[model samples]
Target: MIGYWIIFSATTGNEFSYLTKHFLFNFNNVEDIFYRNYGKRAFIMMKIYSFLLTLPLALLACIPVRAGVYEPDKLRVYLKMDKRVLYSDEDVVLQICIKNVSEKKNFFDVFDSIKNKPGEYTTFQPLVYDYSGREAEITVPYKLEKRDIKELIRDLERRMVELAPGEVFIHSINLKHIYKLDLNTRYRVKSLFYPTIGEDIVITSDNELSFKIIAEKRYNKPSEREAVQRNISPSEVILLTLRAEKDKNWDNYLKYIDVEKFINAYPEYTQKYLRANFEEKNQIEKDFIKYLTRDRDDYLLHYKIMEEEIENSKRIAYVNVIEDRYGSRWNYRYRCRYMLEQYKDMWLIVDEVATVMQGAKR
Candidate 1:
């Protein structure tokens, strides 16, 4: 009689050890039976024994093998908005909450320190879909081209913060200040939070947040007159233009500016160049406005209209803008001179130039 043996390694913690088993059977009478039946019965018995011996091993192969115990996910994310419906001009405050659901402390970049260089940090990239299933355009506050890559990397490296187990971190962002949403439209905003820059672990909310923007109440009702008219001065035009620029209303900005006169004054500036430059300037205006509106200890002291001169249809205004940013870390001021011309009872800005009175830290 011949014996069969089987060996397999059982997986243990970072090590492998083998276990062997043997099966023994007796066929001492098999020689006499083979001579009686011409070995036919012996061949059938051998095949049956071989199959019976290997059946258990074949069934064991189908069992799942586990090298380690299962662990729960480490992070959980949540997205919240103050109001589901709001006016188009109103700001939508988005709150992002990240909670560490694991037992051990986790290290992650909170993304609070890299506002000017958003590309360097993992962010809650948002996707907004309109009612028609079309994606809307969302503009970020800071652009990659505005910051140096090395500086951004340094900021990110130094900004890594720690979150304890079961602790939550919350961050709020103003959607109106950063993005342009359309009026009278419903949008679905979905966001995914990436805790680390180089890792693949991303946490997202179970469901998306929905919001609607309706037209302003004032604009909903019809008026008796064709249009409401208000008489604005040359100085008022400059202020209104600045306000429009701060609001990121590019169309309203061009409304107050005489593009034809601006182009004629600066022949080197083609229409395309003028439009592009206006958009760039609008972006700068958004940044400065954000700084002014920030919830910080610093404050804007005051701004003064230095001088205003009107000659025939042409007018020039000089203004001084100052702010006490971060308690004298740098003197923030701008000396701006605006040129305007009277057009159809409205003062239209023709051109302007500004010089930084004081430069900040590089």
Candidate 2:
């Protein structure tokens, strides 16, 4: 009782005023009010009551702040999944973000900067389930043939990085390529991740990663998207490019054409791009897409890849294209000589020389 009086008297000066100002109610002077309302005994008791009310905040302030904190709300793992409606024509990309929201640095070896899915090279292990929580079917048989994890670790040792506080390392997985998803059914995907990949450190994904594959495109006819593939033949690349444009599937249409390469092929655009700033360069790429799609009259009607020639440095595709537009009363066909080069896993149209086919039909 004597100890309580000492604590209550000592706290009633500044701390009592703070607590009352922020938490309860503000007064000119709490000690004067309490003393005036009652004698010293009642005054002491009321001060003790106020002190008890603010005890938790006082105790929390006494706890020392520490570095390397790994709270769920602080440290995070989550998917940056995107779809303009999956199964439409876009890749089912599950971009994983491993972030360090601490005061100190964090290191993770779970994956390289890029990956198709979690595996020996990719490291994290994933579980995919259907809408009913049943294990999803691996529609396309996945061949997990690769070197051991030890070898991958040895090879990637030099390239690993430490994520500084407030930094995130991201990598993506194409779920559609990994699991066979039924149209309109939701799918849940999660991964077992060890930041160190072998031993102890843990970072958990706080969000439930889920998405659905909806067949928004008409199912009665064949989808050209099926032909939109990685590592496609040069002829297929040319064929899909024209077809994607005709169907107005912007993602696949631009997929086969490397916009940077296509835009820079023209000397004027190339010089302008080199002199332009970052924001302007992005505008130039958008201009390329706009130039292709802005006029419906320029849309391709029918295109046949006539020939594909392969040389040591580059590949060339000759396409005979039929052009028609409601805007044009009568227009003929075209012959486009497309120049392509190997870009990552597939071919992209880098350049094209088109000449109107004078004798061809409208």
lDDT of 2 by residue, 178-243 (tens): 666677777787765566555544555666677787766565575588667545778888778878
lDDT of 2 at 59: 97
TM-score of each: 0.37, 0.36
Candidate 2 differs from the real structure by a C-alpha RMSD in angstroms, to one decimal, of: 19.1
Separate clash counts for every candidate? 0, 0
lDDT of 1 at 185: 81
Task: Please give the lDDT score for candidate 1.
Answer: 0.59
- Estimate, for each residue in 248-350, the C-alpha lDDT of model 1 and write its tens digit: 5666767787655555444444444456666775664454345434555533343556667777534443333332233456646667677777777778877
Alpha-carbon deviation at 36 in model 2, angstroms: 94
| lDDT of candidates 1 onward, in order | 0.59, 0.64
After TM-score superposition, the amount by which residue 114's alpha carbon in candidate 2 deviates from its true location, in angstroms, is 12
